[model samples]
Target: MLAALRVGPRRRRRLRAAIGGISDKVLTDCLHRLLASGLIERHAHAGAPPRVDYALTGSGQSLIDGPMTALGRWAVEHGDELLEAQESSSAKGL
Candidate 1:
């Protein structure tokens, strides 16, 4: 999501490349979800070959700058600990 914002308006193909490891169906679903939530705007230009672009709305930008930033900071602070806990649990088969 942040990557998309950093790049500004992007077509679906660019989004897919920026956000790797996701299936086409998954990316389509996510884009729809974001659109439904009003966090992103979709613009379609009429032409011989249709052009579509996606960009983050003001609300989405605020979310990325606020809660998301805090979440990222928290992850940076405790990610190692969380990974260790997950590894221990997996080793114990629980």
Candidate 2:
């Protein structure tokens, strides 16, 4: 989700499309959490209908460039091994 926002600010619909398959409840929860933590900022537009946009803060960018980058590298290196283990466990019915 943070990766999706790394590009720039996005509306709710755009976010949904960018990070597909997440439930509404989960998405809302995550957004609220990020907002509360000051990792992201939500802006509201003034109009007949309300509109909101979300963008990452400096802290969020740090998180993405630092730990998230490392985590992504780790995943790329070990994802196949993890998948094989999961398959093996399933085969053993465990």
Candidate 3:
């Protein structure tokens, strides 16, 4: 979710599209959690039809720029090895 919001603010619909296969309930729950954690901000617009946008907060951006970046690099470096291990374990019925 954080990664999806990294680009900029997004509406609920856009978020749903960005994150494929996430149910509405799960998305709502995650948005609520992020809001509570101060990692994201929700903006409600006033008009004929209501609109809300979610954007990453400063702290959230920091998290992505720091720890998340490292984690992504680690995944790229070891993804093949991890997949091989998983396949081996599944074959062994472990």
Residues 1-94, model 1: lDDT tens digits: 5556655889989898888888999998999999999999999999989999999999888888899889989999999999999999999999
Question: Model 3, range 1-94, lDDT digits (tens) per residue?
Answer: 9999999999999999999999999999999999999999999999979899999999999999999999999999999999999999999999
TM-score of model 3 (CA atoms): 0.93
Q: Using lDDT, give the best candidate's number.
A: 3
lDDT of 2 by residue, 1-94 (tens): 8899999999998998999999889999999999999899999998979899999999999999999999999999999999999999999999
- The candidate that wins on TM-score is 3
**What TM-score, computed on C-alpha atoms, does each candidate reach?**
0.86, 0.83, 0.93
Report lDDT (CA) for all predictions: 0.88, 0.95, 0.97
TM value for model 2:
0.83
Candidate 3: list runs displaced more than 4 Å: none
Q: Give the clashing pairs for model 1.
A: none
In angstroms, how far off is 77's CA in candidate 3?
0.5
Model 2, 48: alpha-carbon shift in Å?
5.1
The full ranking of all candidates by lDDT, starting with the best, is 3, 2, 1
